[model samples]
Target: MISSDAYILGKIKEGDGNAFSLLMEKYYSVLFKYGLHITKDTDLIDDCVQDVFISLWQIRHKADSIQFIRQYLLTALKRRIIRVETQRKKTLDLHDYEFDLQFSIEDILAERQVAEDNASRLRHILDQLTSRQKEVIYLVYYLQLDHAQVAEIMHISRQSVYNLLSETIRKMKDFWENAR
Candidate 1:
């Protein structure tokens, strides 16, 4: 059985380097992929992710205090990327950046043993959504995070998260119906 995050965190708090490695190993891919959705510069994302890990390691004593590890990492990465990009471009508004959510629905459907045609159709349907809607779909369904956590990560209110999700669902339904 895979070790629980709490267990890994316990070992980390005790200064177990391997446990920290385990934590990093568990989350690196997800964090990186999520990072890709936010920014086009892979190098910048990589640097930000490494910096996040470094910061987390520097505060290992507080590992146990984090109730949502994945959410915390994602939020930190998002902020880091925006900060770095803003400074690099000399932009004053962090909200000026757009989420470039490029989802590979075929890969996801293939993993679930879904047929190719269905994957193509679903991808087509999803392609109709706004970037914010797509990001909400990814955070809520793909990441399986709660609405409140998604709101916190996206820097939006919980009710806005709900509204976005509902709007996405409505649009998807309309698209699917029209496609038939």
Candidate 2:
């Protein structure tokens, strides 16, 4: 049996509007949040995400080889955002923009006094990481994507994903230990 994602892709390739709607409903917010980490412009993010879906629908028949819809969508969205940002560079100083990953303690922690402190500490450590490291950590742990999926989404080698994840974990561990 085809997995739900594959089934959705198949339906989409067959021009099933409902399947495309389901795909959008499933991934729009995720793409938006990921886009936020890449660029601070909300309008750009919205437009890029919309473009990704529209492009996907247009190329659905050619997307039969896609095994992971989320990874494919994320990769396309990231490329779209980067392309838009590059175009904007003609008018704006690129240095003014930063690809910072915004994390919220409330998103990661339960409502407990002790957990709040731990969450804050973790957030600080996360903020200390390089943008690429933070992106790897977010994709792997927060999004629950495997190294292969992360590698695909980030357009990096699987080995690079492993290295980034391991180094980020090592840094976080050292910070946690030193804090104790």
The candidate scoring highest on TM-score is 1
lDDT of 1 by residue, 1-180 (tens): 434988888888899999999999999999999999888899988999999999998999988888889999999999899888788677756455677766665665667676667667778767777777878888998899999899989888999899989987876677455544
Query: Candidate 1's error at 177, in angstroms?
Result: 4.9
Candidate 2 backbone collisions, by pair: none
Q: Each candidate's lDDT (Cα)?
A: 0.84, 0.81
Show where candidate 2 strays beyond 4 Å.
88-98, 104-124, 175-180
- Measured by TM-score, how close is model 2 to the native structure? 0.81
Q: Give the Å shift of residue 137 in candidate 1.
A: 0.9
lDDT value for model 2: 0.81
lDDT string for model 2 (21-61, tens) is: 99999999999998898888999999999999999999989
- Residue 10 of model 2 has an lDDT of 87
Model 2 lDDT at residue 20: 94
After aligning candidate 1 to the native by TM-score, how far in Å is the CA of 180 from where it should be?
Answer: 5.8
Single out the weakest 10-residue window by summed lDDT for candidate 2: 90-99
